[model samples]
Target chain A: MKNGIWVSKNGRVSEASGLQPRDALLFAPHGMTSEDLLQEQRSALQQNIKLIRTRLAEATRR
Target chain B: MAKARVFISSVNEDGLKPLRRSVFRVLEGLGHEPLMWEENLGPWPSYQNPVEKCLEAVEQSDLYLLFIGTRGGTFDAAAGVTVTHSEFIRAVDKGKTVLVWADAETKAIFFSGIAWKLDEYIAHTVQESGSYPAPMQALDFLRSCQEAPPHIDPYVWLLLHDIRQRGIYVEDLARGVETDWRGYFSDLLRRGLLLLPLEPTIAENSNRLEEAETSFDLLAALLPQVTLEPPHDWKVWLNTIRERLQGRTIEHRYGRWNRETVGSYEACNAASLYRRDGDSMRFISCCGRASAVRSFALNDQSSYIALTYAMGPRAEQVYYTESGQKFFYCVRSGPFVATFHFPAGSSWDQLRYIRYKDSVVSAIIGPNTRLVKLVRLLLGGMRA
Candidate 1:
């Protein structure tokens, strides 16, 4: 119901912000300074890798 | 490369006319989507500046193929550039693969110092004389001999400079403009042709001319696709998406798209999710051309609203806006883009809907879109 809530696959609720600024910047549309698109893409990918690691850790740990 | 949506841009209608069709045929034959303004959208809706639509295509395309020649397309005073010029800028900004085919003159202009000299000449004249030289005097000064580059739109050089700055490779059309323009405008009208017909070409230009009808003959090649009405099961379809979103209710604020630009479109009316009213652009051309018979007759191509919602980590929803209706989406799963529309009146809780309309959201869908769902796309009747 609020921002910053995401559900893990196994009926688990996690409270944290949604996509980070690094993630959001990846989708900035055209006509804005797109010269930064490549850099934003790299940042978004790196952030995604970190988030995936956290989620995987939570799922695998006993 | 995988099949891509290619945008062919040119300002010289007559000069590049045949080449446009050939490029269209070749791309279409290769199962790639090729978008051309006149063919894909009927002479841009008069209600909105048509060039705006072209820029949007540049934004959406995976590959942008540009034709640079003597003439520059119509200039938008508000934007301070020609339509073709703006398209190039957008393709560059969007970071798409831009393929430029430059005529000998255009190539020379870009690799040469003409554009810089011209800019400096004008600036220097203004600095010293307190005003620009008369148009003719300025043209005369641009080159040692005024025999060539006759009456060109100065913006052409600027566009070439932009190509250079972006480091995009320029494939020379090498087919230079004929140096026989003692009176070129009269010559085109007297012969009444834009350019000679061509075999399919991505790089093409010609000094020859033909009958005017020759250019439009391929207009028939771009015959409209079959328009479909909305399917009866849209509610069921949308329900499936809402479920797969894993009950993820996207907070409207998470998108990266600046809501400011979305609000800028003439049609966005207070940026309301519900347009204040349907546009006549849906029914007629703003320029009074034969709109009824053109591709816009289906009305789905140009007369809708687009919104993308990225709820969380790869979960995105692309919504379709119809006049005065509540927006609904066509959801994208890994390989499938499931098309669905939220029924117009059903989803609007006035206060919430109004809030959703006003708030800026991030862009969930980036530049790439799969082609499989283009048919059942938001183009189908009512909504997607």
Candidate 2:
């Protein structure tokens, strides 16, 4: 049995699924785990970094 | 004609109340009928199809006014079924006119509820100038509308009117290369194409114009043209040259020939000749060590050369030599043609030979020898 809370579209969280202390959370809204969120954030930051570098290069060229 | 009907859509009632009222007053003042859902809808209407009637009303109206706020909640909940969101969507779908008023500060919050993918639909975001939020600033905005002398920028208004007649992709129009009316209009006119009316505020228009002007000015300065007068039969002469060299190609080269002759050369398997009306003769040659073709124009007994060169390692050189010069000489290292004024009675001995090579490798050639050879090549050519 998966242990984590279930998050609905409206952001309502339900803990119906039961199972252990260290088990991974499952079925949270879009099925995104904490790690997934962190990864997404990391990716967004990297994209922003790339954009900034490109802008800097353009500015220097000018 | 019946006064145009307008429907105002807003997500946050409190934030938009004042705007809603002002909009109503403005429409009424203009002798147009203005309607808002809160004012028009019956109390506690079934949520099942809360937006159905609004969509219907929007369809009947000539224009739809959208007030975008930043917060999400009931607005997002009712998005698919609310009078505001649905009405705007339906109006757009029906090809009705749309005027979007965005509360810049609140836009992020308002849009947060919407899926990020749908954000593109919300274009034309403008910051409100007043100190307060949408509701607080409505009165001032209304007053400004009233006080703003009836003198709308006719050009801007004309664009708006055209937009109404033929819908446009707002995002594309706003982000076009020529942001100002003049440049935008010039581009449109030059292309012989008509664009839909979509007017930015005066400030936005001016800012865009300035940016475009600066960019074009810089480009023009970097590339200056040397003008020449053509012979009376220049065009025919050029055509004859072209006919003679129709099948051959040319190659371009750039390098230092000797100590002082650092420049570029263009050689071709075939050459085309042309004459302009001002008695100018043009020679075009293709196929060389480089990919660029060279064009030589002769006017007033002087020759002007123009060639394109690669910016990187395989760059070309350009040089000029006068007739009777002993050694060929170079003028520049990049892809450019330099014009040489032939000294009185000077012959081909002053002419120079040009070549192309890698910049790093070409640096090894002595400059003095290059210059001497350049003059000699020119003199030799003139004698030949």
Model 2 stretches astray by more than 4 angstroms = A1-62, B44-49, B73-83, B107-384
Summarize candidate 1's per-residue lDDT along B131-222 as a digit string, tens digits: 65553455457545332265666556656755654557777775543322224224533442332222222111111222222443343233
TM-scores vs. true structure, each candidate: 0.36, 0.26
Deviating ranges (above 4 Å) for candidate 1: A1-62, B1-3, B113-148, B176-384
| Candidate No. with top TM-score | 1
Interface RMSD, candidate 1?
A: 22.9
Candidate 1: give the clashing pairs: B46-B286, B255-B361, B255-B362, B256-B362, B256-B363
Chain A structural similarity (TM-score) per candidate?
Answer: 0.45, 0.50
DockQ category of candidate 1: incorrect
